[model samples]
Target: MSDRFELFLTCPKGLEGLLIEEAVGLGLEEAREHTSAVRGMADMETAYRLCLWSRLANRVLLVLKRFPMKDAEDLYHGVLDIEWAEHMVSDGSLAVEFSGHGSGIDNTHFGALKVKDAIVDKLRTPTGERPSIDKINPDLRIHLRLDRGEAILSLDLSGHSLHQRGYRLQQGAAPLKENLAAAILIRAGWPRIAAEGGALSDPMCGVGTFLVEGAMIAADMAPNLNRELWGFTTWLGHVPALWKKLHTEATERAAIGMNKPPLWIRGYEADPRLIQPARNNIERAGLSHWIKVYQGEVGTFEPRPDQNQKGLVICNPPYGERLGDEASLLYLYQNLGERLRQACMGWEAAVFTGAPDLGKRMGIRSHKQYSFWNGALPCKLLLIKVNPDQFVTGERRTPEQRQAEREQAAYDQAPAEPQERQYNKNGNPIKPAPAPVVEQARLSEGGQMFANRLQKNLKLLGKWAKREGVDCYRVYDADMPEYSMAIDLYHDWVHVQEYVAPKSIDPEKASARMFDALAAIPQALNIDKSRVVVKRRERQSGTKQYERQSAQGKFTEVSEGGVKLLVNLTDYLDTGLFLDHRPMRMRIQKEAAGKRFLNLYCYTATASVHAAKGGARSTTSVDLSKTYLDWARRNFSLNGFSDKNRLEQGDVMAWLEASRDEFDMIFIDPPTFSNSKRMEGIFDVQRDHVQLLDLAMARLAPGGVLYFSNNFRKFVLEDNLSERYAVEEISDKTIDPDFARNAKIHRAWKITAR
Candidate 1:
């Protein structure tokens, strides 16, 4: 091998620039950047050093030769020209990896096989003792890259990817690769921060990757110092003396670095399950003295190192997969921002997220953003300076001004020491200090009015709800036009739905009023603020309303009509059980004795559970969503009504058509509009009601009753059906007291065979 060997260092996409700088710093000569790779020249010593020190590279390839090839034969001869005896023993094992197939080698597998064949043929001895293939741990690993018409063959000097620093055997579900984590730190300016002896913290640290990587960078430690294996360990061209010299120097440097006072590096994770694993990883990285992880939540995250200390707050909060997930994740990002504002003022923050929009919702402005890829998912690193000017609040102030106000507020809020008083000879004092007055947060006038309205409603409805044994009900529904929202009490939890204010309304005022209402809710309801779940409601079409709003996957059990049903308050717009349908479900329970029942569009099977509780012989529920069906199954199992209750997953129209059984009672409450992909075509409740009802009525036995309902305010039943079957409007009877204020909540009817 020559003194200067051509080297190609590969990395994850979007880290090409960072890797180029890092490679040049590690003695790589004349470095040039490529897509996901950096090509340069380095000697054997530099190659070994890069393998041990390059934090951003996935692999280090030492180029053997670059030959032009027009066909597979040329590729075979090109590989054959290399001296196989000098690289590996005749009985050694090797692995070949080929990329960019072309020039009559249409398949990379064929190209690799041809290269291997050429080497094996040349290395075969008189006794046919040839080198065998060892893909895992080989004596030699050759990489052939066919670019355009030229073949570039090289030897792999890094065995397993350099990212496998050997400390992260256990990680969270979505772990950033070690190299990628290092790249993020470098881009976030952790190196410079560490050089300044600044602190570091990760609010959502998963197994302490960032803390360990930051500690390594700050402590001047090589990333792979503890790694026991390397690609060139078994290669014939390996230089043991030169590698030993570089390794000893790196070891001494690390010792000297560790002797310095450790920087204040810490990590906090919300998941208690990850606390021990994070500690284990840090211990493995030999950074236990510098980094500490604690079980904490984002809402309560406080990185209190030393007084007056400020540093980087880096976290990789989860970017949820579904659109509905944004609802919950929005609050997560908000809580993170709130903590940053309250506890980490004057510090810097770096938020890495796949959802840039969610990052924007953090109530902070990013001064700079860099695009990177987490595997195939493109992500963004938002760099923020946690100062007063970067806050999304309408009021703008400089950091100095905010600091002054904070200091003044602290001085003013400090309790005055009790005045020293003269005492008599007895133990009792002549005079005692007056008790301190604790001031509470004052609500706005509109908020007070809203709170009074809620109290009045709760006073009137609480009695009725207790008498009726209702576990869930709507307490207030847009009672005041200014406060256009629906508040529901589910057990101890409060669910508030803020109807999107009209575009004509001044948004700032509306937001202020909503904030006031939110502030008054927990106080009025006498519950903790953490128990409140809020969602913004807007006009929805098709199946958009059914889409998940959060990924909580949490279901709360509630009782109605003597049966237990499950409701997921955070995951969807509708909380499984519809309060307006409570009376209808009770009505079904009243008339379901000894009769067969069927429910179409049986969301969560609440109505079916009521029927089963009413002693129905059997209950059949059908819906298109597997998620709802699963929920319905849980409801059935919760009430011990699983055996005779049939839960079918399919389009209700198709299921009804395919059914031949007869039912004595049927109830259907469907969406106003649906374009679900599972169904063959679109369904508008107003347009398709007749066909849906006709198909459903075909399965109705003689004298059976079918109750069909919908919430479309402008719906009108086909008049001709009244002539075929005796039909009567039953909307008035089904409206419960909770839904009485909004009488247009749903319309219902009873159709029976004439």
Candidate 2:
């Protein structure tokens, strides 16, 4: 304890320089800054002070040892060399955080486990007691770093990241980290402006992070005055009196700071839910008397007209990072720029945004740009002087121009005399050439947003499909929840299905979005409008799925895996082919060669077709729907499959129980629930799956395989069935590229006879 130890202070990246300045000001010697971190030598007193008073630091780590490690063996021995008893008892709970890779340590979890084992083994031999691992609310937190064949071990002195500040009970979406907010204010020179009696404002404050941090800085209060826990609280090394002195000093300084602040500090937010938390954070920080937060939009924001103000205005606007994020937020940034330009004509404004291009959309040129990192996203802070001479608001058109525009509009609207049409020489009345059709009124904003999402998903799934030779694929799922539709592509044709929207959404808005989305789909996929057929997909009962929506009886032949099948876009609720099950079909094709195949509840017999094409000795397809059975026959004939492929029109359960035929391989994928009049009784997959599997197992030969599949999201198998045979769930392998995003699209299992 007599030696001066090295202390490493970690902050968010791009704040290291600020932290370095902070450490130097705290009287810590040999201060140096690195990317996202800083280190300096300090005694116990200075270290305690940093934990209590420093606002920019995330963690204060005390170096214990550094050693060269050649392998996992070296790592174990290196940790074992230290006497952990000096820090924590054998029965205490602790947690180890490990980072970096070397010396046969590629997985961080495995590395942490090894470190835990070494410590446990070392302690248990002497005391006969092992320390338990506590991930949450641990008594001690140990940090381990393995870098380039070397390791640095440290004890976390602050316990949790110091940025927590202990005031935020709740936060809005994408709240800024507290310490990062403080660092930003420092970089924006808020403290200097406050010292000169300038106002501070956060127009887009969420959860009051910037406002609270700004008040703390302005009032000269320590950041950790309210923190009740520290890493050294439970350690065996006790220097309680020195720590008590530092905390007492910090508490007195905060009490004095709280009585002096009545500065013009405020925040504004649009969400009503965020208002209370902002107030709550201010109250917890003991700054409620000095700061006020209200609910309002940026468009109506302006400084108090009565008070002449020269201060700093800061905002962290949402930086759109998703496919449709930028399009929706263009007006938000533009409004921010206009608000600054027209209102605060003499103040300084700072905008922190991750999307720099959107910053340009503000129409106000920034005088200064400083680059900073918000977590991993690179961002910029734009500094501008709010003066009309420097940045103009670019307000609406002049009165003269408006008057001229109205006169021109009146002239264009007047009726005109009819003109005679000219014919080539026949003198017959000729009509003007047919007007060219305008590209279906460019998709609405909401529609373009849906199309953008579809295009993004297509670029990702299309590449995966090409690598796997998958032709029929899903191009768009319920990506935008508002649209609530699924679009699939089969060769050159597209099939669309709209999921019923919730009643809460306005019917008109929902209808408009659907219309725009439909109009936009053809353009997004580069297909003719006639090639897309739209339908409503929802829960069906009994014969609802079989009920024909249109009597067109239109059917087209689509080839999947070189096997042709008939698909009716207008006749039924579903296409004859289930595209998601393509991989399962290919599975049957790959493994059914030289094997007998049986497909139960087979709609259109796609699996039977694949099995027969793979050279199966015999294939039998059983289903209750005579319509699909006849369609199955057409699919068989189209693929040159005839004699060996038997299409039986009967209930699969009755067929399984009545027929004594044994098959080497069988595929069964039942509907989630069915109660058709043709069937003997209702079949619920979750309720009758056990009975279904038992019947199929009875008809299987010794060492035979049965593949049971279902789209029932809540399906659960009989656990005792595992005792009867070797059962393996191959659901992951059954999903194709298009349905990968939706893992619950379908589930498949492979069961084998013992």
The clash count for each model shown is 1, 0
Please give, for residues 206-255, the per-residue lDDT of candidate 2 as tens digits: 78999999999988888988888888888777479999898888788777
Writing each residue's lDDT as its tens digit, candidate 1 over 1-754 gives 5889999999999999999999999999999999999999988989999999999999999999999999999999999999989889999999999999779888989999999999999999999899999999888999999999999999999988999999987898678898998999999999998898889999889799999999999999999999887889888899999999999999999999999999999897744557889999999998899999986556557986866888899989878642123444655677788788878988889999999998888788999999999999999999999887898964367789688778756754565433343222222233443533323357889988888899898878876776577768899999999999999998778989999999999999899999999988877776678888999989878877788889988877676656766778899987888888998999999999878899999988889878877867678899998778767756664553332267788998989888999999999898999988889999999999999999989999998999999989899999999988899999999988888899999999999988
Best by TM-score: 1
**Model 1: how far is 32 from its true place, Å?**
0.7
Q: Give Cα distance to truth, residue 358, candidate 2, Å.
A: 1.6
Q: After superposition, how far is residue 615 of candidate 2 from its true place, in Å?
A: 73
Instruction: Give the CA lDDT, 0 to 100, for residue 263 in model 1.
Output: 95
Give Cα-based local distance difference scores for all models: 0.86, 0.81
**lDDT value, candidate 2, whole model:** 0.81
